[model samples]
Every structure is written in C-alpha cells, then in structure tokens.
Target chain A: MRWRVIGLETHDAYINMALDEAISEGIRTGSSPPTIRFYNWEPGAVSIGYFQGIRDEVNLEVCRELGVDCIRRWTGGGAVYHDSGGELTYSVIAPAGVFPKNIIESYRLICGWIIRGLEILGIEAEFRPVNDILVKDKKISGSAQTRRGGILLQHGTLLYGLDLKTMFSVLNVSRQKITDKMIKSAEERVTCVLMHREAGREEVYEALLKAFTEDKDYGFGAWNRDELVRARELAEKKYKSEEWTFLR
Target chain B: MITHSSRKVKEGKIVKVEVDCEDVIKKLRITGDFFLHPEDVLDDIEKTMVGLKKDVSFETLVIKINDIVKNNDARMIGISPESIAEVLREALK
Candidate 1:
C-alpha cells in the first residue's frame, strides 16, 4: 500500500505527541491517508511509557534544570530519553487491519525497515525481540506501538549520539548504579550512529528516507488543517496538562 | 491495611500492585510499564478481585485473572496473568 511521508521538522514534546494522536485518528476515520513522519524533539524530552507513573520514572527537578520537557506516551514500554542533538524519531500511522494482528510481529515488520536504514548508514542492526534494535549486543533503537479504533501508531528513536550523563540524571536510575565504571559498561549496551560512522543527522535521515521509500510507492504530503487544529487542542488540553501527564 | 508489591518481569517490564485489604480485598491499583491492549481490563481485574479472600490460592487467582482477560479479549504483552497473580499474592502476604 502507498504511504504519505512527511519530514515533520522539530516540535516540543506536547505538540509532537498530539500530532501523532491526531494523525492516527484522522487516518482511522478515513479523513487522511496512512502516513510515515520523521520528527525531532525541540529541547529534548523524556517520555515515560503509558502505564508508568511520571514521578516513579523521572527526576522532575533534573528535567526542569535542564529545560527538558517530560511527557507520557500513548504506548506501553520503558521510558526513553529523546536527545535533540543525538537522535531522530519517526512515527508510522497506519490502519491496524493492514498490519500484523500480533503486536510482536508488527514490531518485527516495522523494525525491519529500520534495519535496512541502518544498513545504508553502514551500521548493522538486528531486531531484538519485544522491541529493540541492537548492534553487537548494544541497543541502537527502540520502538513502541499502540492500536486504537482500527488505527496503529508506532514511533521510536534512532540513536545518533548519546549523552549518557544527562540521560542517567534525567531518568530514574538508582543512585547505587551511578558510577564511572557503570557508565562505561553501559556504553557497551548502547551504541550510536556517530560512534560507528562520520555521518551527520541529515545523512542518517536521508538513509532512513531512502530505506522507507525504496521498493515502495510513496508521496510527500502535509498535515491537513483540521489535523493541525485538533493537534493544537489535544496538546493544550491533554498532553501539556498535568491531568493527563500525571493521571496515574 | 494497604499492601503493595512491585515486580520486574522479562524485558524489564514492571508490574506494581497496591491492594487495600484486611480479610477480603477491598481495592487494588495495578500500575507499571507493561502493555495491555484495551487497558480497561485492568479495571475489570481489580473489580473482580475486590471480594476475594486475602488468602486466596495462587491458582485460583490466576484462573480468575485469565477468565477476565479471556472474557474481555484483552491482549497482554510483557505482563502476564501469572505475574499479576504473584504480585497479588505478595500483597496478600
């Protein structure tokens, strides 16, 4: 099936989450086509999994000090630190009926395209079960998905670089686990594109774009006016509000 | 008394359970970073467990949880009925 692709540029955490939800709702109701969008966080952010309690997973003081936004995702998974300068995030909104019915199987199908993208970047990555992309046993990417009303929205981050110190400070890692040796060893468990190649963000983005469009018929598109309006409402009413973010 | 327990399952998926009970379960709140499709099944499970004895057998709890999951057609990934039952047993302990 054909898909519409958009390089959504960068947006803050609330608007980004709102757009994903709004676009998925549009496609679910047949008001828009299935879409693949690439985006980046404006000031970096920490997105906790849907089922997580914000206070339990994040150090809010650290986030505030660093000017990072903290938001909760619509999908269930571990908390992720989206670094503005170190990562690229992409979302795929499609009809759930057109994809695999099994959650894990759909993850594999989507991650396969990311693997191809990594290949073009000269970084060999493998799809680790339950939703992780690994290179030599180090995680390079992680994805999460949610399906509702016949629509599926899957979004994830690809590591271009990692600021381990900042990430550890913002996330809820135990104090006992914070050590030079620990951080050093942690590096062995996570890798990035810059660590392997001399590619910049645009190079990585181009590789992913080529991989997604390669062998498939796709068209460039923009968000519809109604979607922008709905997204703004959702961002202001749901995503940015403490009621929804701290609802747990 | 309010009893609480948290368990980290495979892939670091966490299951945190808090139950209010003295003899029979009065209330339960299950929270964590686990995937459960149509998430409302959590409410159904909590409601079903309200009147259960504090010392309910593990197998019975599992059976009850499975019944709700099946009846609701809920799909749970990373978290399992057994894990939820184990956490419940911990709370009851």
Candidate 2:
C-alpha cells in the first residue's frame, strides 16, 4: 500500500472543506489517488455539524456582523471555529480495505496516528473515545469520519491557539449555562500545544509528517494540476455556494 | 406518545412539520411551501425512524441520518434534525 501526503497552507473554510470533499470524491471515483492533507483556515470561520441546526448551534447574525463565515460540514460533530492562527487541520483519505471495519475501531486506529504526532511534538497526547485527543485531561484535538464508495475520510483539527471568548460568542452555549465557573471549567478541559511547547507551525508540521511516515513506508507528493483544478471548480460550484453554506 | 409541530425555512419558504411519535418511534409528515429534489430523501429519513426508540436520544439518530445523506450526496431542503428536535421540545412544552 502506498500513502500520499500533501501539506497545504492557509485557505478559507469553504475552500478547505471543498478540497477535502473533492479529494475524497476523486479517490472514490478513481479520479485521484488516496491522500492525506494538512491545512489551515484563514479569516476564521464557524462550521456546524451536518445534523446541527444553524440557529441552535451558531449566532448567524453575530457571525455576519463579525465577518465570520458560517458553513455546515459534511461530517457530524458539534459546531467549531477555524482560524489561521488557531488550529491545524488534517484529513486522511484511504481505501476502505486499508483500515478497520468498525467505526469506533477505525477512529481509535487513526487517532493513534495523531497521538504519535503529538508525541513527536513533545506533548504526550492520548486518544479519548469517542473522538478526542487529550493531554493532562484537556482536549487538544477532535475528529470526525465518513466512509463512502469504498473510501474512508477522517478529518480533525489540532489546537495551536484558541479564542475562547469569540468561540463562546459565536456558538450557542446558553448564557445561563455559561457561568464564570463554567468558563473556567471549559478552559480546564481544553488546551493548545503552543501553551506548553515553544515550537513553530512549520516545526509542528514537520514533526507530524515525520511521525506519520516513520513506521510506514510511504511517499510524499503534491496534488496534481488536474486534482487542483477539480477542487477549485468544486469549491466554486458547490461548497462555497450560499445554499450549501447556509444549509442546516 | 407525543405530537409536535415545528417550522423550518427552505428555499426562502416556510415549512411546518407535524410529528406524532411514541417512546419507541415517530411518524412524521412534512407540509408547507418548499421544494425538494427527488422528494424521496425526506421519505428515507422518515423511514429510518420506523423502529427507532423515541427515548434513544434524537441526537444520535440525527447524526446517523446526516451520515447517510452525506454519503449518498442526497439533496436536503436545508432542514436538519436539530430543527426537528427543537420542534419536538416545544411540542413537549
């Protein structure tokens, strides 16, 4: 089995989500090779889970006024905010037969890769089911997965930094449910790698690459021109559409 | 058994769904001004609820439906299960 990994720089949430969908679809339809991608979101955006209600999960008016784009993800999870300086996102696309058959098993198996990556960053992170990576009981990463057309796509984000206040403002945490104690409790439950380590983004990226490639025999490459063109088209035609962005 | 009503906006039009359900499953029929592709996606969602236990936490069922729609690339009229649950919650009130 061969692995293809690509490191992508900052892009908007729409573009990021579109690229992942395009790549996964491409692999499914035999238009592209199975791959892994690392990316960052620019201008910051709030993404709701597929099954979540926009009104219930996010403050849309606030997001509009603040110039933060809100869109729904193709995967199921709670709403999340992604920004350039806040987090690093990764997506892995593999043939279905390459991983475990059970959903939870697959999550654990792939989460092990994240654990290894964080270990390389000198932070001893552990996988916490059903979908989180934590250090000292504070969450450092969260992930979601989908399987289709004999292909598996697992994507996640690792916190490098966070803006909890803005996150709280944009997401629909009941004001009554968010006391000072609750805020402090949330802080205690979540953490960023930059808080504990003095590594730069590039260093962390390299660490993850090394970690993923260490035991497995794989090759690193870039997305071909055709795939890039297809991704851009998909971004323009579907993922970035108002219909899709605002769809609950 | 519980019956609930909720409103949703799809394609700039409002929709009202009336759901009758018990602790084990729900029977839903959506009505209002809206357009949906293939029309069967909604039916599929309703069918998925046939044997589901009402007490089983609607969140998990919604997630399951989301996964199915995403994988099948089904076109939804911008309605989400969360909206349905919200309507149900209000009905319970």
Candidate 3:
C-alpha cells in the first residue's frame, strides 16, 4: 500500500479543520489517498469538543475583545486554544485498516511519533493513556479521534509556546480558582518545546515529520481539483458556520 | 454517590449550583439568581432525572429534558438541560 504525505501551512482555523475533514472524507470514500498534513492556526482560535458546551468552556466576551475565534471540533475532547505563534497542528487521515486494529493501541502507536519527535528535540515526553502527550506530568499535546465511513481521522496540537495568562483568560477557568499560585502551578505543569533549550518551532515541525514518516515510504500527492472545490464548499457551509461552531 | 459544584452562566454572569446525588438525585439546589419560566423547570428536570442510573447516558437524559422543555415551552434562564447533562456526565466520569 502506498502512503501519501503532504504538508500544508494553512493558517486559518476553519480552513485547517475543513481540510482535515475533507481529506478524511475523501480517503473514506476512495476519492483521495491516505494523507498526513501539518499546519498552523492563524490569528488564534479556541476549539471545543463536539459535545462540549461553549458557554461553559469559553469566555466569549474575552475572545471577542481579543479578536480570537472560538469554534467546535467534530471530535470529542476538552477545549483547546490555538494561535499562529503558539502551536503546530498535525492531522492523519487514513483508511481504518491501514493501521493497527485496536483503537487504544492505534493512539499509542500514533503518539509514538510525537514522543519520538520530542525526543529528537531533547524534550522527554510520554504518551498518556486515551489521548494526551505529557512531559513531566504536564500535557504538551492533546489529541482527538473520529472514525467515520471506514476512515479514521486523528488530529492534535503540539504546544510550541502557550500563553498561559491568555489561555486562562479566554478559557472559563474560574477567576477565583485561578490564583497566582494556581497559575504558577499550571505553568509548571504544562510545557512547550520552545521553552526547552535550542529547539525552535521549525525544528520541532521538522522533527515531527521525520519521526512520523522517516521509516515509512511516502509519495507526493495533490488534491484533485474536485476535492479542492468540495473542501472549500465544506469550509464555507459547515466549518465556518455559527450553527456548527455553536451546536452545543 | 456523586457530588460536584458547577457554574451556571446567565447573561454572561456566573452562578454556582451545588448538586449531590446518592444513587438517585437527593438534592438539587439552585443557588444563583437566575430565572426560569414557570419557576419549577429545575425541579421538573431533576424529577425527570431522579432514579436514573448513575451510569445512564447523559446525552439521552439531555435529550429527554430538551424534549420536555420544548413541549412545555419552559424557559431555562442560564442553564440548559444539555449543560446539566454535561455536569452529570463529568461527575459520573
């Protein structure tokens, strides 16, 4: 079986999520090849899980004041903040049988790539159960998965340099609960690769690509013209719609 | 037994709700000054939720409550049945 690896530098959150969904749908429907893509979020955005309540998870007023976008993801997980300056996002879309049979095992296997990536950067990170990659007991990466139409899409963000204060401000962390000590504790708990010695964002991205696809043979492929059109339509009709983003 | 404190937002203000469920819902206290039409939607939601298994699917419960609210045209000030279901799901988890 041939695997296709393509890296995109998309900066818009809606476009990024739409492309992932499009690629996954394409692979499942036999319209596109299996793919892995890397991208970033422009401006900034907060993504909540499919079933999450936006009212409970995000401070909409703060986000509006700061000009950050808040959207909901199709996968299940806690809310996450993404910004151009802070994170590297990756998505893997493949047929269900392309990887291992067990779901949890598949998560571990995929997360192994992240672990290896961090290792190359001299940052010791471990894959936590279910779906998180942690370093020193704090999460550096969080992932979510969705399997539909015989295709599995697993995507996540790698924290390059998280803004803890802004994160707390945009998120619904209780103002009373988030004391200075609590903030310090959270800062100490969560870490980013940029905080480590010498490993910059570009370096981390390169390391991740190498870690995930170094041993596996990959071919270059482009989205067919039809796919590009359909993807854009989906982005306009679904990913960018208030109905989809505020479903919960 | 499940116990947790959840924040309820109404008009962008935060209010706290304390819940204690023992096997079934034993106590449902609404502490925040939020308004609900008919003044008993909370009790109705709680009653509908009472005796439900702790492991019951929260989504299903939310759906039921939503149906009830829609049928009665009840107003739930700052809290939605979905939000309540979310809190319950987190507690059970």
Candidate 4:
C-alpha cells in the first residue's frame, strides 16, 4: 500500500489536532490514502487528553499569561506542552486493518520507527509499553492512538528540546511556585534529542522522515482541498468550542 | 456535595473521580491520563456509577464496569475496571 508523507509544517494546537481528525475521516471513507505527517506547534500549546479534565491538567491562567494556547486532544493520553521549537509531532492515519489488532503490538510497531529515527542520531531509545519512548529510562517521546470507523489515528511527539520551566508553568503539575528542585525532579524522568546528541531540528526531522518512510511505499504529498476545508471547520467549530474543550 | 479523589494506578496511569452524591451517587465524572478505546464507553461507566449506594462494594463497582466494558468490547489501557472502581469508592468516602 502506498503512504502519503507530509513534511514538517507549523500550526497552532487547534489546527494540529483538527488535521489529524480530518485525515482520519478521509482515510475512513477512502477519500485519502494512509498518511504520515510531521508538524510543529507554534506559539506553543498545552494539550490534554480527550478524557482529561482541563482544570486538572493545565494552568489556563498561566497559559494565557505566557501567550500559550491550551486545547484538548481527540486521543487519550497524558497532557503535553508542545513548545514551538522543543518538539516534533507526527501523525499516522490509516485503515485499522493495516496494523495489528492488539493495541500494544501496534504501538510497538509504530514506535519502532521512532526508535530507528533516534538511532540515526546515535541516540538509542526504547519503547515503553502503552505509549512512550525512553532514553536511559527517561521519557523522550509519547503518543496516543484512537481507532474509529475502521481508521486508526496515532499522533505523538518527539522531544527536541526542554523548557521545563515554561512546560511546568503551563501544565498544572502543582499549585506551588515553580522551583529548581521541581524542574530537576522532572529532568530526571524526561529527556530530549538535545540531551543525547548534537543535531539541528531539521537534521532530526530528516532522520525521522527517512526512518518512517523506510521500507514503505510512500511519497511526499500534501492535504487536498477537502481535508483543508474539513480541518478548518473542525478547528473552528469543534476544537475551539467551549463544549468540546470542557467535555470532561 | 462534590467529592473528588485521584489515584495513580499500579499501571502508571492516573484515574480521577469526581462525584456528587448524598446516600447514592447522583453524578460521577472519571477523568485522567488513562486510555479507553471507543471512548464513549466512558459514558456507560459513569452511568453505572449513578444511583449506586455510597457504601457500594468495590467488587460490585468493578463488576458493573466490567459488564459494560465487556459488552462494548472496549479496551482500557493503563487502567482497569478495578482501578476506576477504587478511585470512585474513594471519592464517595
């Protein structure tokens, strides 16, 4: 099967999540091919899982003060703070039948591409069960997946940099003041590409793009008009609405 | 009263429960980092908690959740019916 590969593009939180959902819908109806896209979040953002409580996971006041956008994801997972230049996010949307029916096995298969990508940078990482990629026991990446209407959509982030202070500020880790010790504690459990090797963001993206496309029949592609139209609609109507954001 | 509790289950996921109740659960909300496929099954899980006595047994809660989960063929990753039940019971307390 041929796969569509879209290179890195920048968008806000709402558009990023909306595009994934939109692509899933397209793939479900056979209007679009299986797709693998990499993207960046601009102005930064904090995204909580679908079932997550916004108040429990994000500090909206802090986010607004910091000029960061906050939104909920369509998939289930922990909350993530996507810094503009701190991470590279990727999404794989295709028919559910194309992958293993077992969730863990499928996560392992898709996350393997990440492990290979990191390997190209000389950073050896391992996939932790459910949905995490760790380097030396510290998390370097995380993903979430949701299968619907015969389509499976999995999107995740690969940490390129660390901004624990801003990340902690936006996320509701605690009500206490941000402290060096707190950041230090998080550093022990989290990691990024910069922590492992010296490489530019473009180089890392290229490495990932290569690994993801390896052994697969894929070609560079772009979203069609239908996908763009649907994504914008979902971004404005569903993702940005108070009802969806506060669904919890 | 709105009672709330959260638990970091053994499987490394957090499960939070918010309940409004007197003698029986009036409303319940389950939220956290856990993954539940066919996510709408959450509605059924929350619905099952409603009208349950404040003193409902953990076993009973798990059974109620398991029935819905099994019937829907839903998959709960990083969490289980028992874990959700425990947090719900804790919130009621």
| Pairs with steric clashes in candidate 4 | none
Give one digit per residue, the lDDT tens place, for model 1 in A169-248. Answer: 89985332224225555446778998889998999999999887788778999999989999999999999999888966
Question: Residue A192 in model 3: shift from native, Å?
Answer: 0.2
Task: Arrange candidates, best DockQ first.
Answer: 4, 1, 2, 3
Q: What is the lDDT of residue B2 in candidate 2?
A: 52
Highest DockQ: which candidate?
4
Cα RMSD of predicted structure 2: 8.4
- Supply DockQ values for each candidate: 0.50, 0.08, 0.06, 0.62
- For residue B59, model 3's alpha carbon misses the true position, in angstroms, by 16
Which segments of model 4 are wrong by more than 4 Å? A174-184
Q: Write the per-residue lDDT of candidate 3 for residues A194-214, one digit (tens) a residue.
A: 777566678888999888787
TM-score (chain B) of candidate 1: 0.95
Off by over 4 Å in 2: A174-185, B1-43, B47-93
**Residue lDDT tens for model 2, A8-36:** 57788877888788888788777677787
Docking class of 3: incorrect
Q: Rank order by TM-score, top first?
A: 4, 1, 2, 3
Taken over the whole model, the C-alpha lDDT of each candidate is 0.87, 0.70, 0.73, 0.92
User: Which wins on TM-score, candidate 2 or candidate 4?
Assistant: 4
Top lDDT hit: 4
**TM-score of every model versus the real structure:** 0.93, 0.74, 0.72, 0.96
Better of 2 and 3 by TM-score: 2
Model 3, which residues run further than 4 Å from truth? A174-184, B1-93
